[model samples]
Target chain A: MAINWFKYSSPASFYSLAGKMIPLFAAAAVILLIMGLYIGFFIAPTDFQQGEAYRIIFIHVPAAWMSMFLYVVMACWAGFGLAFNTRLSSMMATAIAPTGAMFTFLALWTGSLWGKPMWGTWWVWDARLTSELILLFLYIGFMSLQAAIDDPRRADKAGAIIALVGVVNIPIIYFSVQWWNTLHQGASVSVNQAPAMASTMLMGMLIMVFASWMYSIAVILKRVRIIILERESHTTWVAELQKDGVA
Target chain B: MKPRHKKLAMIVAGVAALGVASVLVLDAFQSNLVFFFTPTQVAAKEVPIGKSFRIGGLVTEGSVQREDTSTTVYFSVTDTSHTIPVVYTGILPDLFKEGKGVVAQGKMSDRGIFKADEVLAKHDENYMPPEAAEALERAAKAQKASLSE
Candidate 1:
């Protein structure tokens, strides 16, 4: 009966809640990442054809998935901010953009490394790669657009519209493997088929995915706190938090 | 019932609609993106000519012919047993040579020659830029030694 979702919609309340959640997610992320790496590198069988080079998949695929997933989540937050005019939602969207871009770059870098040994090319303008590059550009564009605007509210509205428009590219990136003649391979693991990889490899990838998810949450929470402090600097709670040296 | 909240509702609805539309469009266009085939796959009569695609494999020994600005390179991509011949005209990557893996993007010609528009030299993950020159030097020395023998 005491539950009030709207009460926590205020930046101060959400900041405190996010602060508490960060440590837990960070710890989980570290543990899952270690386990994932151990299984992927040491326990998984070497690919019969690609030999040792195929091990890059454990990192590459998860990073790629996270890149796409984080974009969608950011767009969702941007949408929430635009529709509800929630200060916290826009802050969340802003916080997530850099991390999403980082993962997208990591995925492309690792994929190039993987491709060189297996496909005999360091780069290909295949559907998946091209669309992913576009996704990176979209992230950069959104961030730059927000930074270029002086008014915070206007920035948020502009960013939300861009994010919404760019949302169309996410699905295109995801299904590029299936839609076009790309050098990139098809999905090795899908819900419809048994994974083409060993159980250990599959487990490693899943664990890494979970780790990435937790890591994103922790990073976003930390970033959201900073945004709250900057935006609500004049508020009494912020003043008190600053006095306590917490903000 | 506040004006802000009402505006928020409209934006959320717009995003959802866009998300749905993208999923449908992507699903509809999911088949035309494939552009690469292994030599073995092509050998099995699996590749359709006049369609753009890619071929990946090692540069065949003694198949590189460089003429001033333009170079003619021939390579064979093999998935173990099957090998496809790829012919390319362009500047080969500095690291490109015999037994080195390379991928060329283009379409197969009617003459059964794999005509490439772009050539990419594949290097190992542990590659150092300086190592390419060293590799080329070592290869030349080994070839010279073999001829003298």
Candidate 2:
């Protein structure tokens, strides 16, 4: 029999469900982080050209990927909220912003560290780099706009509009290396060609990517639960949960 | 505002937002999206004269010359169709080797030479281990030797 898919779409149900999943995801994230870092540092051999400094890719590339990926996910959730007037969808979108921004900041930070010795500068106005910086700003803008609006419903709509608009930057950031003569390099991994990285290096990077994904999911779920509690505080269901000391 | 009227207004606003978003993405792609100009663009005078601009291309083989007493170095950057000689009086990046990609930021001198204040290495996507890199190099040498023989 088909299950009712919308059961958890309600904030009240999703709250406890999210709590149950967060611990599992958080545990997975921690385990994967350790394995990824171990393999990244100990198992992966030194690069022929970049030497030991290239190990930073384990963090940089995965963080960069997640920064973009989370933005898309946020936009999709925000879009669903705008279209269907789903309160849970909007809350999820809002919950995702800080984590996505954090990842974006991490990506830029690690990238500069890697670029300094390899590319000879901490930063440049390259299309890829600038577009990424724009992503960070977009996340900040999304959060700030939401915070500024007193009405949560109106804030969701405004944030959703901006999120949808800023989705265009994702493609520009991904293809900036190809579309322009940017100082940034092209992608190391692509679907059209065999990955250029050594197998062990690729493994470490993939593990780190999964780790980032799990961490983002766990944090977003936790944040969404708190958001539900805050927004539905006046509701009878929330009052019952709070009375029981579970909220 | 009435609930019905507010709902209608929200729908209108959402539609407007979608329109603006589409227009923005289209404009972003269609506009001059170049981050740096190539040697061909520089040769064609597409780059403005005397204004500081970036030029990106492969560092021409066997063209790097270093001054012993100073940090100044001269090299030619080429996109195969055209070339620009660049003079920089600063430290080069680790990846700034002959036949490798580079981007230099500076303006043209009175004699049409590029005097760069900064240089950056443009790396490729390849990220193999040292063993694999050496193996590839050895294979390339063998192929070249066979071609010569």
Interface DockQ of each model: 0.12, 0.59
RMSD of each: 10.8, 4.8
Question: Could you say which candidate leads in lDDT?
Answer: 2
Tens digits of per-residue lDDT, candidate 2, B23-129, equal 99789777656767899989889897879988889999999999999999999999999999999998998989998889889998988799998999888888888
Would you give the TM-score of chain B in model 1? 0.55
lDDT of 1 at A154: 95
Q: What is the lDDT of every predicted structure here? A: 0.80, 0.93
Off by over 4 Å in 2: A1-3, B1-33, B43-46, B110-112
Best by DockQ: 2
Name the lDDT value of residue B22 in candidate 1.
86
Candidate 1: where are CA atoms >4 Å away? A1-3, B1-112, B115-149
Give candidate 2's error at residue A105 in angstroms: 1.1
